[model samples]
Target chain A: MDVKPARRTDSHFVASLEKAMRVLEAFGPEQARLGLTELSIETGLDRSSVQRLTTTLHQLGYLDKDATTKRFSPSIRMTELANRYLWSDDLVKSAMPRLIDLRQALGETINFSRLDGTDIVYTARLPSSRTSYAAMIIGRRVPALNTSSGRVMLALREPGERQRAIEEWPMQRFTSQTTMDREAVKRLVEEAAETGYSIAENELQMNELALAVAVNRNGEPGGAIHCSVSGTVWTRERLREDVMPRLRDVANAIG
Target chain B: MDVKPARRTDSHFVASLEKAMRVLEAFGPEQARLGLTELSIETGLDRSSVQRLTTTLHQLGYLDKDATTKRFSPSIRMTELANRYLWSDDLVKSAMPRLIDLRQALGETINFSRLDGTDIVYTARLPSSRTSYAAMIIGRRVPALNTSSGRVMLALREPGERQRAIEEWPMQRFTSQTTMDREAVKRLVEEAAETGYSIAENELQMNELALAVAVNRNGEPGGAIHCSVSGTVWTRERLREDVMPRLRDVANAIG
Candidate 1:
């Protein structure tokens, strides 16, 4: 006879509310509009549960249903949550003007990202003349141990924590040039701690060179200011002499 | 004898889930952080309910709690929902290239807004050199009758729907120059129908001039492309001659 564990339940946790969020979270770039059955499959909820949650979300103006197809998608009202978050975030509010100034001055894609657990989530983005649609969207996350912004942010953490992240945090080979060796990554982090900036060449995107400087809030690392340019058009020496000072200035000015 | 209506209930609707959303929706620019009592007041829920919802949201990564104060605020993960919305929106995805081109060409603030009920919600925003933080934020709503983008979108609707909107939708006098009279607003909508573009000067902002053209999807009015410039620097005649054609081109280029 096999012993089974009881389902986890807590007095303070609302399981149904989490289920409802799963319905909304089911929508992504690949799974945009989903029929009830597809939603159930994607969310791993029973058909009946999916139906009730989708209905409730639709009625609350968070999800939109197509009248003809009966498929469900996230409504524009969903942006309201993001709007609230952006407005309430003091770091993002203070960084916007400086980010815009940097964008105008550099004529390259500028991004502001903050450390979230083991990832860096892009809080704001200012696209240049040739930026792609995918790059322009906010809220995209990248591994903290594999990118310039992430390394810069990690460089400011306590030594013990930074060591733990370098050893334990996951790293993906986003491109052929991505440094997968732990010793190489550790040296990069140490260099960032010494120089106050980090550079990753062709790490995330092919032919892209990224430079980042950490933004401090009350003497703690809050986020990083990043500028990415085509590796074909920029060299490390030129980037350091010409762009590093401006990036440092903007990052320092941010809260 | 007094009779009170019983609380409405439906099998398909999850009341607890809606209540959970109410907790998240309570945070705004002014009400960023909220204690248990404040959240209960703002959400109109009992203390215990607020606590459960906040705890669930915090554990689920939607809300953040201060270490010492124990107050709750929305977390950066909230942007993930907005990200899903933007990625799944067909109108926004198709309009990005044209909107970006228009922004670069004109060197002013560019917005893409879609009609949602009686209001227009800005789904995307590209800032100019002088654009403010408030102006750059996406997901802000403006009335359909007062804004140039709103009026252009309204102009493309059926006459009956248009009439109802002009008469029934709420209007706010954001600036002294806002057109408050229903008949005058009707004329502006009619003019938009005739001219294929609409312009509103000093309506929402004191020194701002806005011009918009509707973007069509499958031969139906989908959204609008907007360009706003300093009123002092632009005249109606100059805007019409220099900017209207470019706006029209971009609007037409979008799906």
Candidate 2:
């Protein structure tokens, strides 16, 4: 039901394949395992279609079905596709060594992300010695307008495109200190464009400050290298003097 | 073409969905991007079918197509499915804190893997400071007979199943030091059964030694926790005395 109108009309679109993917995606943190009825409800598909899709997915090794519970969860094979993506991504491959180097030098959480539609998706993450389970995970996404990496990438874009994003892209207040004002965000993007880096404080997470520099590929901004530190431990001025130069150097070293 | 005979006959099986997955999987480390003809040949499907599948996947945002080269590769959206799997997996969630603790305690690589068919696929990996890109990647599968983690899981299995795995499963020689002798591997498995831990030296890599212990879940061996060290920096006796107890403690902590 979430299929775009254009895809609905496109003859090459495989509706059943899309539905099967939806079934796999429906198993997430909140609903890790779902019975047939739950799957049908979550996917908004009828029971018969959900049954066929689940059966096909289970048979194909993408979904694991519990014998006693009859509930289905994503199988380990699902990670293989992600592995393929990681192996194939040119930006991730090129940025990894530098990201590791940055993590070692700064002893802070390092991330590489790229713009995808209206969000920035983390492609590579190297957590500091002190980090959480969620902080280390790859493939996490956030609104492009709210993250320092997103702001850096957006700042490098054409003015017209940046204006459209500022006007139209969805924005959410993740933290009390998040900058939801369009004019304020525009000023931050302008500052990033002029200074060649971006900084965000307590926007995504309270008591966290993030700094990012764009990595260029072929002449355009390919992605961003981000370093996050605890706001309680260091002041903004100290972080700028101590970390920004090294961050830029690592970003420049990457593709 | 790789569809099993049973799946081929199953009325609920979705062959087109399988074909689409195959197309996505065809893009890997060696062949990051594929033209329509290459995808057709790789997937063993005709050009028209490959074309339709690629189009469908691209429309669904799972495949990225190059405008100039007219080639397709997996998009970042593919990682979302892997993220979903990571979040849904109870074992990975439960094992993460322990794995991180072990990694910090040992200053070496740590991994959690489970058996999938004839292979053990890494579900979580925390790389040492000295590590390669391939070593850090999750979802990398190695033959269950060759890895210490795999052997530990196999050692904990029913004797009949262990014998079947030792006798029937495929084995490949990955390195000059790889233990290709079935008798030697069997002895190692038996030793693991007696010791409640497993070790492999220069088997998967020339200068690497891996140690593992089975993590039990509800009275069954759920998976194995692994710690890999440089063989040049560690001897068998030294590793046993210095590392094994801590490794076992971490493995027992996970479930």
Candidate 3:
């Protein structure tokens, strides 16, 4: 085991709290659960200390012990902890009423979004009608460069900020259909800015069609809301004619 | 200011990490962002420690700072850390595909859920529409005894465990419709067992309608998947005929 870093003579830092935060922060998208050995190896903390902390965490219900293996994994308590986010007004919770109404009117999926850096973070999303893709969670971050929701958020940003973001990371074709150049993006956003809505066809995902209208709060927004349908069922023309109008109506309702 | 708790003892605990975790954990649902003074008060850590730790966290992109106010808040990067749980196969991530299909087919909100002692934890949720009421987040929890997802999860528990649970704490209704009787709950579980799904109508929330079905490995579930809609729009007939069939269909798809 790696030794604890020698403390400064001044005891300037609370080494234990830092270590515990490291253990907490060490848990990420790739390393959700860990045994004592894994925690020891991962954090370079002594096995004894790791074991002690995990035990404490378990006692507090942040983790659970596997019956046979005795390995420690995140308890649902971790979800409770995450629930305490600053954006705790649960986009999912507040939006459900409007979201369900929109879904019923549109007969498809919808997403409630917020800006995270330049990317569009899906704070809340209704499910798509088909079963194939990955589930979009409340905190899921996808490229602002790729999603229709991302673009709308960018469109909502100040022009200078938008330009900087596009320059910082321009679009890449996720499949064959994503917009590839800054010009294409600007034109799309310009039209959206003019017409008050945007559409992306097979832009980020194969066989995905999405339409979004910015929900201006009272005509102001914390961010945007989007309603989408599968390209598999709704062709581009039908979506533009049918889905767009309903999405706009919902966006206006939110606004 | 309260004196440092860990400092009072020179025990083996790593003070810095624990203090840092407390600093981070101090930002809960009610208090999402805080200035150094607030952080100091919340964690009972000195202002300097809070400043230094938040600086490191901000540098790492896990915390964000307001330049003018110098208040520290959690960044979405914290969600990225929690997303690790969603990728753990056969744990939570494994259910995304089914969860998506269920949401899409039902055109109602769907979630991958689990039991955390007395609470039901929503790991992943597919919203049905654009309105917000039932706030959703990765680590959010609702008392298990008070929700459809919770009841379904509780029903899956070993009989002895269930008995001990109600025995330990009888149910309390959050809304008038919330179950408050332990014997009544046992009866409800019996009904749920016979019917093979769970329903909560304006129970947890007076105006929300929710139904849940467990996603089982065989007869037992790794977790549950739930669909919630606004009670205003749903009739009992619609729920029984329309929602239950679709909810069970999705449940059947569960591994």
- Cα lDDT tens digits, model 3, A1-255, are 122455323345444545555565556555656777888888888988887677655554555688887876655555554565535444444555777677666656677776666666655556653523343545566677677777765676677876777778645567887788887787777676677777888876777778776766543345677766677677868977877777676666555
What DockQ would candidate 1 receive versus the native complex? 0.52
| Model 2 docking category | medium
Q: What TM-score does candidate 2 reach?
A: 0.95
After TM-score superposition, what is the CA distance of residue B210 in candidate 1 from its true location, in Å?
Answer: 0.9
B115: Cα error in model 2, Å: 1.4
Clashing pairs in 2: none
The best candidate by lDDT is 1
Better of 2 and 3 by DockQ: 2
Task: Put down candidate 2 lDDT per residue, B97-138, tens digits, no spaces.
Answer: 777777666778888899888899888887765666777777
Error of 3 at B111 (Å): 4.4
User: What TM-score do all the candidates reach, one by one?
Assistant: 0.94, 0.95, 0.73
Chain A accuracy as TM-score for every candidate: 0.92, 0.93, 0.74
Model 1, runs deviating above 4 Å: A1-8, B1-8
Ranking by DockQ: 2, 1, 3
A115-192: candidate 2 lDDT, tens digit per residue: 898899887777765566666677777889998999888988889988999888888898999999999999999999
Error of 1 at A132 (Å): 2.6
Q: Give candidate 2 regions above 4 Å deviation.
A: none
Evaluated against the true structure, the overall lDDT of model 3 is 0.65
